[model samples]
Target: MKIGLYFGTFNPVHVGHVILANHMLHHTALDEIWMVVTPHNPHKKKHTLLDNHHRLEMVYKATEEYDHIHPSDIEFKLTQPNYTINTLVHLSEKFPQHEFAIMMGEDNLRSFHKWKNYEMILQDYDVFVYPRIAENQEEVILKSHPKVHLIQAPIVDISSTLIRKSIQDKKSVQHLLAPKVWSYIDLMNFYQ
Candidate 1:
């Protein structure tokens, strides 16, 4: 089985995320996509993040109906300041039966070289990149790394930051997230 690993903080799972996962499943050769909910992303600001447990619950709520899209808390058991290379290495050892590929946005590809043992990651695993509107610089970077493949998933302009701000401002996030996820956020008072 070939699996695509889509890692994110998912402060609150949104529609854009669901759409992207669906797009990847339908368009790519991947059999399933595991939405790996990271506890802390080294590249992101910690102050803006929700608790990992809460974030994981939201992802679970959002993806519960879809068998192909799974919410994973695999990074929670791993060390903090989670790095992709270490996670990939651990996953490879534990799930040797499945072929794993890294799913990421073009924006992340631009900074791929800065990641820990990035060259080893590129050589050992396939990276699937979805285009981001603001990160056109990824093209230049991908030119240097032949292992990276550009995927034409629908670009989602929505981001977790925007959703958090909306909740903080007491604005409606009706369509931004799944109904269950929105209810969970409301129940927990997340981002408020």
Candidate 2:
């Protein structure tokens, strides 16, 4: 099976994520998209993130009804400071029968060169990049790389930060999250 690895902290899975994944699935040859919930993203502050299980549960609730969308916790067991190259290598070895592609936003592509062993990753795997609303445009060199595919997906402006802030402010986030996801957050009093 061909899988698109959509990795994120997913501190809380939101509708924009599911919609973007679904868009990628329809426009690409991918069979399924696994929303890999990262336990610790090197670029993000660990203190700001929720417990791993809580985040993972949100992903589960958000994607339960979609057959093509799945939640993954593959990074939780890995060593701290999870790197994309390492995760790619591990997934390749464990799922030898399947093919994997890195799914990311154009904003991330701008800094793709700075990632550890990024050159090696490009040489071995394909990268599916979607557009992002960034003040600075994505670097032309990386965007035009043979291994990097630019997908014309919907530009979703919704962000986890926005949702988190709203929740902390005790504002309604019903429109931003899936029903089950919102319910889960509400029941647990998360982000408040």
Candidate 3:
């Protein structure tokens, strides 16, 4: 099986994420796109993030209807400051039959070099990159990388930060999130 790992904090799963994952499954050679819910991102502030369990639950709620795209909690059991290379190595060993590739936005490609064991990641696994609203770093980094694939996807101008702000302001976010996920968030009084 070929899987595209779309790793993120998914602070709260939104429509943009769902659309991108769907696009990857249909447009790419991937059999499935796993929304890997990172428990903690070393680069991000922990105070602003929702609990790992809540974020993972929201991911599951948001992606439950899409059979081709599933939510993963693989990072929950791993140590803090989880690195992509470490996760990839572990996934490869546990699921040797599956071919895994990293799925990310072009914006992330801009800072790819700053990641731990970045060279090893590029050498060992394929990177499937989708475009962002104003992304310009892809060409710079992928100019000579054979394993990096640039995928053209619609750029949705939405972010978890915006969603959280909307919720705090008591604004409607019906179009931003899945119905179930939105209901769950409201029921649990998250990001309020």
Q: Which TM-score value belongs to model 3?
A: 0.96
Instruction: Please identify model 3 stretches exceeding 4 Å from their true place.
Output: 135-139
State the local distance difference test value for candidate 1.
Answer: 0.87
lDDT of 2: 0.92
Q: In candidate 2, what are the lDDT values of residues 29-120, reduced to their tens digit? A: 88999999999988889999999999999999999999999999999889989899999999999999999999999999989999999999
Which candidate has the highest lDDT of all?
2
lDDT scores in order: 0.87, 0.92, 0.90
Winner on lDDT (1 vs 2): 2
Error of 3 at 2 (Å): 0.7
69-174 per-residue lDDT for model 1 (tens digits): 9998899999898789898999999999998898988888877878899889998998888988873543446534777888887889998889889888999997
Task: State the lDDT at 56 in candidate 2.
Answer: 93
Clashing pairs in 2: none
TM-scores for every predicted model? 0.94, 0.98, 0.96
Instruction: Give the lowest summed-lDDT range of ten residues in model 1.
Output: 135-144
Cα deviation at 91, candidate 1, in Å, is 0.5
* TM-score between candidate 2 and the true structure: 0.98
Ranking by lDDT: 2, 3, 1
